[model samples]
Target chain A: MTADLLQQTIWLAAVLFAIGFIGLMVRRNMLFMLLSLELMLNAAALLFICGGAVWGQADGQVMFIIVLTVAGAEVAVGLGLLIQLQRRCKSLDIDRLSKMGETE
Target chain B: MSSDSLLSLLPLICISVTIMILMLQIVLVPGDRLSYWLTVIGVVATLWATFFITPLLPQQATILLTVDAEARLFSQILVICTLLLLPFCHRIPTARGSSAEYLLLLLLTLLGALVLASASHMAALVIGVELISLSLVVMIAYPFAPQYSTALETGIKYLLLSGVASAVLLFGAGLTYIGLGALEFSAISQAFTDIDLMEQGLVLSGLMMVIAAIGFKLSLAPFHLWTADLYQGAPLLSATVLATLAKAAMALALFRFYLAADLAVLQVINLGIALLAILSMLTGNLLALFQRDLRRIMAGSSIAHFGYLMVLLVAISTLHSVEGAAQSRALLAWVIYLVTYLAATLAVFSVMLHIAPASEAFHQTQLKGLCQRHPLSGWVLLLAMLSLAGIPLTAGFIGKFYIFTEAVNGTLWGLLLTLIAASAIGLFYYLKVVLMLISPAEGAEADPVTGRWLTRLPIILIALFIVFVGIYPPSLIDLLSQL
Candidate 1:
């Protein structure tokens, strides 16, 4: 809650976000990419909560909750699409999912 | 915060409640016709109510939403666009009996656009964007047909990329909040005066991240990889929504963000947007040149249009602090250009949707001697292409002319010249489509479908609007300048 703690929390969040961004780039699998996205969102939420505690305002907390809900909905819809894609292509490899283009 | 402010949010509240009630009614007694009619009625009623709600002139609906006159005008545009396209939704052939859920998702997307258009705080902006993109994901894959495998693929691509982009935007917003200690635009503008942007590296980088995310959404070049693929894959009506509602909402939101921001690093932002505009125009036109598919062609041309809009943004920026005459005049030109682009998009897509409801793509070769088979549809398309090409006596020409003048007056010589050259290249591809429709095919087999008059009606009406506006644009331009 002190200024030092707040700066550290932000530094931690920034590091976490960098890791997620790296994971998203390095991973080719669809599921891991999505999880990386979640990691990034969580980092954002951490920053919001830390900022709210420091500023003594509820707006940041409210934003965190909304981001959480959005992440859930995105995952749900994402998994549904992935499942359908898996059924057709018989694999989860990103390279294998390129059948949407004109194959002829 | 005040009761009066809450009262001013009547239109947005109406849309939210309508979505909820529609959800409840569906669970109680589900019927597609009933749901569709309910949505139609809801959107119309909200559109009507938007006008009647007497604001405190321009009141803050809450800490997040601002009920300003510009917001009202933009809300009117979005609502009217939805109402115009609802008929297309009704006509879009979905599997099985119940597409009530489709109606729900569409309404939710509208709600998102409504929220986004009025967002004055970072939290509201984040929520509004997530709402729009999430709801749009469901709608994009709504067809769920075996052959529409591309639709599902596009859905997955959109989900992942859009999620990442939103996360990026949210992270930037969080950084901004930490730097400024408040989420409201007013707070940020106030902080801009006290804080030296050169010293506040965190705030500068945060603003950059936010702009990058917006550039991704706008599909400006270098960040526009997924546009052609998504446009090619999504269903026609959904594509129309993406091209018009989603693009317009994101553009206006970015416009408002810039409007509210009193940044010291103003040149960096302008240079960034201006460079993006130039890149989009060059890259978009070059990509469209050899493409034979209609959807991809439309997608590519839209990037060029995005570039043109970006030019106007620069014009607006230079004119922002000037007396009312120039600044408002720039905004009016931008809005009229948007309206014309919407007309061209709707007119083109209506015909395409009706002609190829189930087909994946409309090839250039497929339309050989289309004029002979269906004159109404043919002329509808011809007019669309002509307008899109900014040919004389069409809405696009006047729109482009106004924007070009704004650019010259603003002394954006580099951007202005780039626009002129890109538009010349644009005319090539646009004409290819028009010529494909008009030229008689050798040994051509007559096409079978003439389409319903109901389908032809929208095309004709929109095309007529294009011609009407082209000839008498001053009235509308005058009206927009008043905003």
Candidate 2:
């Protein structure tokens, strides 16, 4: 039963990771992209934990702590920059912020 | 965490002290002037510690972080970069934020890069990368003014893209651990040996994912869309940090990982990296051909150089089966290329630091008559361009010469031809800029040199160093072969 549970968790993590990866690419909204990034990060964290559980080792969980810390840092700065972006562009679409590319 | 092991981390500890004291000062008294000098002192102390204490390093500083000779060398480069950027660090003219906070973040970023330079395990890699990148996001967006929206916009783009990059890196790392049951780099060779490459597809896929992620960070082509935007948008000093320190640390980390992993069997990996090299060379040079913005042009030039670096990387991997002077030469080629690239980049960016006005809109035409206006800086930029173009009597030429020799040794003829063509395209734009600097402008006012001696000295000294190294590269070669 525990083996089935671990397998199920791994499958779920993979699904979420795919969803996040796709959403990050497909979404035009900046906020959605940030959310997708978070989703991907948490998915990795979930995989690390389950992988550790299967191996009966603690390194996976140890890695998760670092992942969590990184996630928090990213969110803190990402949102701050998001607010700044909103103020400047007055919109959340990434398409509008494409003025930086080389102009021929 | 023993006393002896603690001794090995003195440099890290010194930087941490710098961070703590800066934080305390910010809490007790915002806009503290003393923090600037404190940050400088901290970087110097860390350099001294890295130089003096690393020789007596403990056998292990833990599984996560260990001070190896390679790490020590990269650390020396990082500290020296920080030392050179100190003159600019003192005066950060911002809209709302204080320079104190800026200095704190700068030092923190350096600390993270130092960890990356020496990280032996996966955790330190993630942590160090995150720390450096997060600080960068804030530092890019820190100087918020009503007029300058480009910085904010670019910061958001970098934040989102870099965030996704970190997640990808983490996921890849996690998958690798699942396959190998170990996260330490030392375990890579053992895993490659034990597992059948065709069957354990997870391990290979996972490693490839990690490579892709790093390529994003390093701004390799196809993943390099953000390089020009970020370089053009960030403050000159911040751009310098991104171009020089962050990329060097990532390249060194990749070098260590590539050296450790078994790559002789994997033909696909080498070809893939070579393709990226070719793409980067084409994209970087072609994009720069049309750019009127000086910052954007440098951005493109950096991309081309990264492509050149990748050729050396492929050479190293192709020659991985051997363990002799050939192997060392491959490594030496990449390091020499990296070193000369950094020096030339620093010279260019430092000149930009003085030339670009408060609004940060850098037009190529503004460089006209710079030689007549501010002869010292104009000449420095001129020399920097020559070196960057790999022209004769420049450090870049020697670096490229060594790279060409190694490419032949590895027999990467296709990449060699591509690199040669890129350098040809590279020379045109580089000369265009040089011509812009020396020639007189139509109606522009005379832009005099305004910065103090502290900043000017480094730019001139670095330009001179480029020339010196170009003339006598044997010394550097001898030193590299010793390494």
Candidate 3:
């Protein structure tokens, strides 16, 4: 990739990351929050691939693969926990999950 | 890699092979007792191997890992902690029945921690962190009792937050790679020192993001919102793992990274870490003062403890180079501080788990007349509280004293003042718990269930070590200073 193209890619990844972070903050539902997390992770992966292509090295691409694997594992465990949360709290809203302080 | 290089990785390999074997045993035989004993033996063997492999002396196992003395020391500490924690895991009341999987997850977490302690490449760093947090997510929610519904909430919260932190860390690492065109720590350091050839903005922001992500994992101030909830919500044993192994691994990794980094961006990074340290100290202690539950108090206190440790990062920045006498002193102080913190934290949690393995919240009132009823646990908790408070003639005091002197030597007057003030504030709640433990109950309180000697042995040894180290600090100082 050309220098100009790599700069543009960086900007695109930055913007994508901002969107994901905002989505994470704004969303109240557990599933959407997890999706937002995936978005953020993908943006990071994009940055790695862009860097790899521009720098002419395999390490960035290797990191990209690793990031993808990490994101996949996170989602698998996340969805499992979310299902359990859904069953126990009877809701997927993060606001409804404030049962920490009350006496059992 | 040569055979010697593979041999240097004996500690990690031992743990990994043990985890695989435990997984197979769980699948086929499916017995908790057998699995538990198997894990204990595996961890003990790993601990022995870690010590045994030290003669090899700083071998690079691959491009990914550096099995140095620091790595070996932390690996030993983590493995020993796992061994100490296994009995409590077995003792923890799991209403969900058949908790053999918890042991498996714990070992995986240990493997992650060991990887982190030795990580010399970006890939190793990310993998280690993900392994630790993901397994922790499952372990946090392992006790599926309806009464502890917050366990699920804590798990979800930790999962989402930790996920964000990992992404942030990766994004930062990606940007860093773009600026420097390398993922190895040595290359990054070399490129960073040649500042004119680097993209300063890319490297700076990328490093800041990486530090912020680590701060979240460490639960420093402004990133510490989830700590109290996690402490209160998770099972006590898992919380102990979170407090000791997880924090120690991340902190040690950060410390090693700081050691490898040159002076190009040292000023900015040091300032950021110093700010984090101050905020964590003030906020952790101040927040703990109002907490009624023991776990929540520990949450606040742990944040503060890490804050105190962060000051050493600033001390490193003050040194002219990485190989100075001052730097060695700082490293010595750090290891001693971490060891004492681990011993004291494990002691406190051991007492908590022994006291109430089934309760959701360990309230202050629950500890009424603990000394009169259960002298051994009461004394251990009291000593732990005093050690945490940094009172003289306790292990915590020794750790604090070294940190105090390092801050003075570094001329960090502002941070030193904050450390002093925070410890004072910390002393209140710590003593409050101590007083409550020692004082007689207002009404009738049942006697504590003093479990078998096996359960009490860890606490007794920890308490004895606390006093032993406190009175004779030179032995530890001499040993660690050589590192």
Best by TM-score: 3
Any runs in candidate 3 off by more than 4 Å, and if so which?
A99-104, B144-147, B195-198, B263-265, B321-323, B445-450
lDDT digits (tens) for residues B464-483 of candidate 3? 88999899988767766657
What's the C-alpha lDDT at position B282 in model 3?
Answer: 97
Better of 2 and 3 by DockQ: 3
> Candidate 3 docking category?
medium
Off by over 4 Å in 1: A1-7, A100-104, B54-56, B196-199, B263-265, B442-446
lDDT of 3 at B167: 91
Candidate 1 chain B lDDT trough over 10 residues, lowest sum: B192-201
What DockQ was computed for model 3? 0.79
In model 2, which regions exceed 4 Å deviation? A1-11, A86-104, B144-147, B196-199, B262-265
Ranking by lDDT: 3, 2, 1
Residue-level lDDT tens digits of model 2 in B1-483: 677787878888999998998899888876646878778788999999887875675346899877766677778888888888888776677776566888888888898898888787888888888888888887777783433556777788788889888988898888777767888887876776686654257667777778888888889898999998898887667788888888888888777667656554566777878998999999999999889998899989988998999899888877777667798888888888888999999998888876653546688887888888888888989999999999889999998898899999888899999999999999999999999998875665675556878787778778888989999999777765645
Q: For candidate 2, what's the RMSD?
A: 2.6
State the lDDT at B327 in candidate 2.
80
Error of 3 at B104 (Å): 0.4
Docking class of 1: medium
